[model samples]
Target chain A: MSNIALEVRDLVKSFSLDGATINAVDQVSFQVRSGEFVALVGPSGSGKTTMLSILAALLTPTSGQVLIDGQDLARMNEKQRVKLRREKIGFTFQSNNLIPFLSARENVEFMLRLNGRLDHASRIRSDELLARLGLSDRLHNLPAQMSGGQQQRVAIARALIHNPAVVLADEPTASLDTERANQVVETFANLIHENGRAGIIVTHDLRMCQYVDRVLQMQDGKLVRTYENKKEIRELARGSIH
Target chain B: MKNFFLASYLAIKEVIRNRGRFLLVALVIALITLLVLFIAALGEGLANGNRQYVANLDAQLIVFLEKSDFSISSSRLETNTVKSVRRVDGVADAGAIYTSSTEIVSLPEPLKVSMLGAEPGRPGMPPVIAGREFRGGEAREAVMDRNVALRTDIEIGDVIQIRSTQGTEDEFFDLEVVGLVEGQSYFFQPTIFVPPATWEIIRPQSQSELTSDTPYPNIIAVKLADPLQTETMSARLVDEISNIEVANIETTINNIPGYSAQQGTVQTQGFFTLLIGILVIGGFFQIQILQKVPQIGVLKAIGSSNGVVGLSAVIQIIVVTMIGVGIGGGLTYLFSLGFPPTIPLVFNGSRSLIAVILLLVIGPLGGMVSIIYAVRIEPLKALRLG
Candidate 1:
């Protein structure tokens, strides 16, 4: 409990469509400790994206408390929340939104640059991270020049470069093939554990769950099940559990 | 300040990466700048050409006939009027000036010229740049303006024939150019100065005025003891001297025929050009921001503030506008070098400076709407994540 990096208490997000209220996220609560990698597995309309957006500080929940490193997000203003997001939280979208004008290394260094931490050591670290992700030769290439899997790996490097307290990714491997997806997820898990950071990845593919320490399954905007045992999680990844 | 630097960095990098696209936009802006500058120069040049002679007069005040309404051509003052003006208090010196239009048949093209009559070494005589001034009563000696010298081959010691209507016949007089004065254009034509006696004999006359010998001058130019007291002296001259209206050089210049209308038209063209520049720049930037909505959304989502995004757009606009204006200024200078003096395209320094400042300011002003649009973009809506 002392090492917990993220805490969500009774988080509920509602939306109005055609004069009817719908709950995108309803009374969801979870915790992830430092050095832990968690996978959020759900169906297409299972509120996974809404939860990720709230964690990224991009959307506000109607009623809830989201605390990162023990600082409640609801207590901060918009400016302060933006600062907190840049300094303490890192996220990658489903499209791996790399700036097209920036090269692969520049894309990764942008995260550090946003936090004003882009120094010589961070530059070296970015290069090392790219090399670890097997993109050593593509460092100077623009996003248009790289394959989808390579771009996804670059996105992962960008997410970790700033050393944020919490890293959230939304379908980061959605564009890659199965083998490329597996390699990217394994390297992501290794980097998160090595850096002692809390990480959450939202994905519909169950096979990617093998690299995560635990799996939380969501349905109809509710947390339905939790698979914490390593063997059971592996069995779920092997497609034995519905 | 830190945010500004970061925004500038991003803007500069994007500009460098997309140099070709930005260069094209800059070229468009440069062309628009050139058009505006050229129109402004034309307006100044035309106005200058019309009033150059009166604008450079040595006298501080011009006395015209009481009902002439400040027009030098319409005013008629007898020799006694000039003498009375000389006797007025604070008057240093006063001279009578006779003006009329004639054609020079010495040139193959028959160039029209404004013939001015002035006493040598008097207030009405312009300073000579080369050679000697015409004698006080010399009938055939004249000082030609430099524009006449530029348009024709008649130099000092060359004889030019002036053709004027006298009574029912056209008479020609042979005059030798003794001196040259620069930039004394009157009514958009090159001017020549002759003595009063010769002007009276050969100046244009209607059929009915063939026998009139009054030798009335068009106006009287008055020099004051203290140039700073021009307004008081002008009032005193009008009050003390009957049958006369007093005016300063500026009022005399403004009363030139078609001067105000020409200036106003050219100014309108330049104004429209600037307005078009704003619209074109605003439209281009608005489209640019719209196309990059997703990229801006991503930046916002990753913790970039609206200030940073809007500032980057502003910096980009200013940089592009500066480059465009610089290129246009260079091109204008180069084009001016190739223009002949007859083109009436003078670039006055202060006026050109003001025009350049306005051109630079329009860049940021034109980009204001686009900056607001970029700042107002919602991150979730832009990324389609909501």
Candidate 2:
């Protein structure tokens, strides 16, 4: 397979409110190659979540196309799109949306179950994934029984356990402390590189950008700047850019 | 099949985690099932009480007076009509019987009884279970129903005094019980079978009709040569005889006074009980779905199809309902054991099965709204991220 895991083409999304059209995502494009972790930084109402939703194939764009693993999202029927979402895409919301009734290991294995590939080997992988995220002792605890940091790590494990082509996380560290957030992001990056899967994280904290391969900044629903150089990315992570 | 198993697994897990809440709802369903089953039992008991005697009549056709409007109590045919009915084609045997309700003097407080007089070994007489049948030329002799013997101290060879309200003054007759027949109650009273001639003398008669001396029967029981030809034989009898109406055994039983209305009331109550069950189950599941909105959203976000979610809900309903129904059936059986035989409660296997099946079906029917609600829960809004 080619290394280019995701390709976007002038993606635009608009919402009509009270007889006015607002461009939530303007004509913008980016590509994510395999084994690369990218961070999307934006202010409130900058359309980061909307762009992430489109990339995950949870929402259809008004124009342009999102191609994941060489398959166009818009061209597939609802059934095919649902199958693609289950098989090729993994995502986590800001709240660490874990199934409250399922234990930590069950929650991670749930992704494999959705893809109809859950087996003895996959069960072992789920346990290994959680253990790598520093949740080895809390595998059998429910989401309600775990701390916020622990739950977020379990969510990360769930996202990667199914081995999807693209993994998306929206503010996954919002509920964790500064130190734990750093550990989670660093572990997330290592997992992405090890598995050779493309990963994208949307967050407001530039300090988290140090773990990512590149940083894409958005302003007014447009990709205004990019920090690809190691020097620039490190400066942004140090809070040195006012 | 995999989806079904997964759905069931999820449903069972939730129920086990929240067992107290589910148990409360299940208890309510059990009580409703108990009440409905009791109502059905009462309906069967009351029907059996009213129609038991006529239903067991060996004759296929019951000939009534044309002017009585199909009412067995008011139909009166003279003795000559019996001879004419026996001569009709396709008639195997015809029997004359007279019936009256009167008080027994042997009991302290006016024990009412339905007195039926028929020729021994005829189609109208009930089979004797305990003692001997009537011999030839037996007079002032009677056979008491088995329930009467069991309920009272009366036995074979006991002389019973009956007080008749016929004529200007009351007449007393000493009749000896010679036999006992089982399940022969009529009109909610234990019946006593006597000779036709003796019954005519003791039957209530107005002063004007007392001196006529014409033997009259309330109805005629006609046995057809081929019982399957009930319709054609009945039509032929009505054509050959004048001033007579004919009905089959089922029609005759249905025409009993208050029988139809009693059964109708119980059936209506049973139907309303089922409706209430549906409403209760639907309301509970709707509340459950509303409370589990976020959980449902998470499942959907992880790629659970609507079919999976809906099937899980249905499985939950079915499991809960079966548990409740099983408990109710057991409780009903236990409760029925303590009731005395005099009470009119009866539990039949087939009718109870029908009621249980109806309850089981209603559980899913009631949960349909909740299933739709679960499947329609949008993940974006439920997670509050939209």
Candidate 3:
């Protein structure tokens, strides 16, 4: 099998607004291998959200090929796409939408429950993952009872518990303070790398780029630069390369 | 099967987590159910009060005068008509029945009572429970219904005074109660049965007809040899006997004055109650779904299919409705135990069962629009990412 867990080739998504067609995602292409964490960073309206949505299989591109674990999304029907999304993809939104009624552990195990794999071992794994994220004491706490940072960490645990081929985080730390943001991102990175999952984090905060293995920057719906060197990525994380 | 379990888990957990809000809505539903069930029971009770005597008649056919439109008050049959009806091929026996209304003055309060006169050992006479049946030729003996015994101190062997208006003056005749029979209520009043000769002497009369003694009965109760062949026997009796119309027991009961109108009014009230139930339930769930659009979107994004979401909502509605109906049923039973028999509230088992089934079905039906709305919510739009 190839090392690439997610591959996107020339993806384009266009929307018709009051009769005129505009391209939200214009001919974007990238590939992330297993165990690699990539950061997609750009200004607002630079097609970062559109790119993430297309990668999440939530929005169909006008024309493109998105293959996760060697299965092409464009060739699958709606039912098949939903099944694929459940089995091969995991995403957390900007709000960290943990179901307010469920406790921290139940929120994490919901992913496995959706996939019909919530057994005793998966339950134990859910507890262990939360414990690794430093939420062992807050396992039975509801989202309303926990802090914003604690809720975001629970969201991250939920994303990784299902062991999907691709893990996507869209502004997972947007609701936290700077210190809490750095802690959440570092833990998220460690869990992704330890599980050998291809992880993608979409953020406009340049400091969050420090935890990622590579940084892909976009401008005017195009890839403007690629930062791959460890020193260069470190400099970008310090906000010196903007 | 796995999907069902998952859906149930989510639905039940949410209901438990937010029990206060759900329980309030369920209580509203329970109140609605109680209203509907009470209306149904009232309808049954009123109809039963009107037709109990006619409904309990042991005969299969009631022969009324032709052109009387099956009305007991308007129909008149001569005493010889009973013999002609008994001579018919399919009729086993026939008896003359005379009906009138009078007031019983023996009690502290004047109680209105239905007076029916029939011969002893006849099909029209109800079975005795307390005392022996009155002899056929007795002029002053009577048998009272159990409802009369319930209302006052009158019982078997008691001499009750019957007050009737005759020639612009109220005359009272004394009669001894010889027997007590159960549940012979008619025209919403307790009944007293007497021999035909005594009925002729004491029945109410208008001042204009103080001297005329018409020896005619209101109708003839005919016992059929083959009760299952009522249709054929009715046709044969109409053909054999002139100036007479033959109706089965059900048709006779339905034709009682105000019976159909009472039933229709009560049924219409029940129907409107169910309509209000639908609106209340529908409105509550619609608001609930609107408030949780974001949560639903997040669920959709996390690989929860529309099937799971829709199924979960349905399960929630059914669970809530079951709780409401269960409480309503229990409350209805407990409340029914406290009512006096004069209030006319009775719950029939099969009718109550039908009402319960209707109550259960309306829950899912009322939540259908909300279910469709939940299923159509796009994950991208719900999260406000698009």
**Model 2 misplacement above 4 A:** B102-113, B128-146, B153-182, B201-215
Question: Largest TM-score belongs to which candidate?
Answer: 3
lDDT of 2 by residue, B1-386 (tens): 87897798788877786789888878877888898788878777777777878888889999999978668789999789988999998999888878888778887656788998787887788789989776535388889888877777899999989888776888888889999998777887888888888787777778987887665888899899999999999999999999999999888888888888887888899999999999998998899999989888777766777878889999999999888888888888899999897777768735677888998888888888999999899766776656
Q: Each model's TM-score, in the order given?
A: 0.95, 0.90, 0.95
Candidate ranking (DockQ, best to worst): 3, 1, 2
Candidate 1 residue spans exceeding 4 A from truth: B337-340
Q: Would you give me the overall lDDT of model 1?
A: 0.89
lDDT of 2: 0.85
Q: CA lDDT of A15 in candidate 3?
A: 85
How would you encode candidate 3's per-residue C-alpha lDDT over B142-248 as one tens digit per residue?
Answer: 99998898789787889999898877889999999998999788888889999987787788877766676655789999899998989999999999989999899
Instruction: Note the DockQ of each predicted structure.
Output: 0.66, 0.45, 0.67
Error of 2 at A101 (Å): 3.1
What are the clash counts of all predictions, listed in order?
0, 0, 0
Across all models, the iRMS values in order are: 1.2, 1.8, 1.2
Model 3 spans > 4 angstroms off: B208-215
Model 1 CA lDDT for position B234:
90
